[model samples]
Target chain A: MNNKYNIFLLATIFTLCIFVLQSVEAESESVYEIRNNQIMEPLVEGLPDPMNGREIVISRIGNCLACHKISSIDESFQGNIGPSLDGVGERYKEGELRLRLVNPYYLNPESLMPSFFQNKNLVRVEKKYSGKTILTARQIEDVISWLLTLK
Target chain B: MKFFLSLLLFSLINSVAGRTENIKGINDNLYDRPYSIGELKSGRNFLQKETLEMELDDFDNPGMIWVERGKELFNSVLEKNNLSCNQCHNTNKNSLIGAPSNFPKLNKDNISLINMEQQINICIVDYMEARPYPLESRELLSLSAYIAYKSKGLPMDIKIDSSNEKFFKRGKELYFERIGQMNLACNQCHNHLEGKYLRAEQISQGHINGYPSYMMRWGVVASVHRRFQFCNEQARAEPLEIGHPDYNALQLYIAWRGSGLLFESPSIRR
Candidate 1:
């Protein structure tokens, strides 16, 4: 009778432990889903080679070269303030890169990079571009296309 | 023992909740009235000279090199065009003195005004038919600092009309907005904590008079917009685009705010 009581108690403890572990895992998974859901929809679309569309990126005239260093091409170019982009294609997936280019600080809240797709209402600006996005939707697409080629 | 443990956990959670509630209340009242231009100036005097040694080797003295580089660029004729800035304007430093302070002026011919840097780029792109250098490029910095250095000692006099009022207001909002995981505002450090330290460096009042100034940390000259870009990044907030309207508005507001402060281009910082 004593042996039987001990076995019952052990089983009850094991069951409780499993239940707690499963609940914690479920909570973490839901949290991750919610975070991903908050990201902008455009970021989920696709990623392309930014180098192939260099003309478009440069013409969008948003000036990514001012801070970034893309060493695989353009021997004359040298900008070290921002990070290097030689292997950015391999480092991040299309969705991750898109989100970063659109709004870098969203991923690393301390990032100094500007948000290209953020609502103008949230960002106060002067009269001319007050309500306007810095880069147009197509321009952002072009830049993203070019960045995807950096691998 | 179980009851005591539960009580401890409950108290810890309650304390955290109370602190969070207090922070939310403070954020809700973020905007009180900003001090007026006159009022703010009275408290902050830009003219009060410090007794610190002014040395050329100091990283803050990028003004000297910028002026030299600007002179070189101004004299050299581009390959596309055999024209130089010296062709139109007198090359003499005395002649060009106080020229840059009156920029971003209205142009009746183009029906659009241009800043000093924009004007330089226009000459380079249109007249010289060359690709304009990037905004924060070393060449741009040297030229801008040289030009601003020529206007050293001139009082800032940026005019604000009804068209620009909205821009000024936006700049003001940005100046005070708290962002980042740290949740710190520009005013929290620049306003209330001036002369204090985050770690080792003492904070300045963020006066903009000496902009297009040299930074020791960067080992190069930088424009006010560049500095603002740096600050935004430091705050862990998204930076505005260079030459973005928001940044331009902030520039205008800063120039206006530091109106009486003597232009101190190439000034040094820690």
Candidate 2:
């Protein structure tokens, strides 16, 4: 009788473990929902910070300044490959900017801008950066907020 | 304060002297030139004054060390046949000078492409009865530097004939195809913005006339393939192994693209 009872207990524990593991994985993977041409929700817990976003725009990690010129910024040698970011806040809506930051390829098939948040479908990514997004969900949100203030 | 002032002065002087827009390609009438001949500038023109000055002086150039080492290896005789590269190649009748200009040519098979380093290894294995030096090894780079040094002033003249036309087309295609997370193609920065600054470094016209060039960052002479690997990594892409056939194809294309530029191998780069 005791042996049978112990077997039942083991089965119950195994089932519980599986359920917990799956829920945890789901929570981590759950990011944002995309609507037509927009990511209609914020991705993380904290409020977006424009100051941090500005840092990322010029930083090596984001390197937006490498291809996009911002005449408002005092830094020299801004690139001219992409459209200038000046008056961008006036040009784009909040959700629209968010979508572009998340994945510009959705809008333009041949967009040179990197998908700052999406990691899948990238080819030949360096081993160090494999399975990692260029920018975090929070960082993307911050960049969106900062870009909205560009006007 | 004094150091800052001096730096300010130096940059001002550099800006005036280091303008790259005026520099022109060697040939004004290159056949089927991609960019205007007047707009084509050698990578050397984009360098800072200090680096340029260092490259101009043979004694001061660090790449010369590899050339010297290669000379020693070229003259050294093997015990079995009592043979040295000097015995065959150094003779006035069969001098190797101006040979590197037309290299990365088709091998005897007429299918496989062989660059300078591979050709050296082939001679070592086939004739000298010795094991080949590993790719990117010090010995191989040294030999390449020496060979390239011999053709220092000669124009690059890679011939992409009917036999090699397929490979040339493949190379050109790869040059324009976007790869990596950065979604960058060679044509994006190298072809479009040769004189523009990407951060502190000025972009060059993506030429391969300086293979086996001395890179200050590595403090060693590097092959064109190794430089390509560096470029791939910078784009956050997985780099292919050195000596890959694809890289050989790219080298052929780049060599042909800048066909009239002088072979400035063992040149300094930062």
Candidate 3:
């Protein structure tokens, strides 16, 4: 009887473990809902990790420094093509920032800023990177989080 | 306080003397440095201190190797007419001094721009009755460097009038026109980002007062045409041929930009 009970316990534990694993996976893969130029905060807590976001903003991958200047980073020279990104967080909400990162042209047709999370309507894409976003969804979230800290 | 003031004054003078303006501005002429609201300085001024010191060291500069080889080649007799470059142009009074400072002239016959190397080819093919050296060949590069070396300190004085105006305009348009997958024009970086870091390197006024320049990246002497190919490739654009007529016109315009700067051919770069 005790052996049978032990078998039943083991079966129960295995089923519970599967349920826990599925919940974690579902949480991580949750789709974001954007409305009226604002987006929901990231479901994956570490994705738009503020630290990694800062790194991306400075690299050629973001090329933020190429067109926009950030007063925080004290470098010899900065570009003035785009507005200085000082206090950008205070100026823009999380949703607005997310939309800009995903596709600036969606908001303003003439915006020169490239879409980091979508890869349509671009020119001269190399074979290696064709039909791919400039950054992953996680990178976009991270940059958004980092930009929010500018205030 | 005095030391700081002197340092400031020194930098001020350098900032003023290191560059010049066409006075008429960028649009009307091909000679002006585009996107520059201020004076335009040579790329030489932006070179690192160590690089500048290396260029000043005449004996150690790697470009000297090509220059020396060029001297030997200039005197080498062609079996055809017992002629050499020395036979025609290397005279005591008419020595090649300042010869390189003025070039890319309009060939009256074809109405095409003829640079120094092309002019050398003309002499060999027509005057000496020998075959022309292939473009960018070691022999040609050597001869070009040797001739450029003769004009080391002379100020740039290239001629530009009706004969070469159209070519100059074409070059100016090419400079401002964005290219490659990156979609960056020369003015975007060389002008807009001057003194700023792009790919982690300083941008100077895209001047080429120093041709047959020794770039540390190539580890040998490189002509201006080779460098143009590099710029295009870096932007992920298809590079034009080294001796393309369009490139020649661009060269003519850039040389004019270095109007007052002394020729520092065989100079070192990194």
Ranking 1 against 2 by TM-score, winner: 2
DockQ winner among the candidates? 2
Clash number by candidate, in order: 11, 0, 3
Candidate 1 TM-score for chain A? 0.60
lDDT of 2 by residue, B1-270 (tens): 546545744653343233222223212332355665466677899989999999989999999999999989988976577777788787575578888866677888888888889999898888887778999999989988998898898887778788888777777766766667675567667876777766667889998888789999999999999999999988788999898888888888888888778888889998
Where is model 3 more than 4 Å wrong at Cα?
Answer: A1-91, A94-142, A149-151, B1-40
User: What is the DockQ of the complex in model 2?
Assistant: 0.18
Quote model 2's iRMS.
17.2
Off by over 4 Å in 2: A1-46, A69-87, A106-110, B1-33, B36-38
TM-score of each: 0.52, 0.80, 0.68
The lDDT per prediction is 0.58, 0.79, 0.73
**lDDT of model 1, residue A87:** 82
- In model 2, which residue pairs have backbone atoms overlapping below 3 Å? none
- As a whole number from 0 to 100, the lDDT of residue A148 in candidate 3 is 95
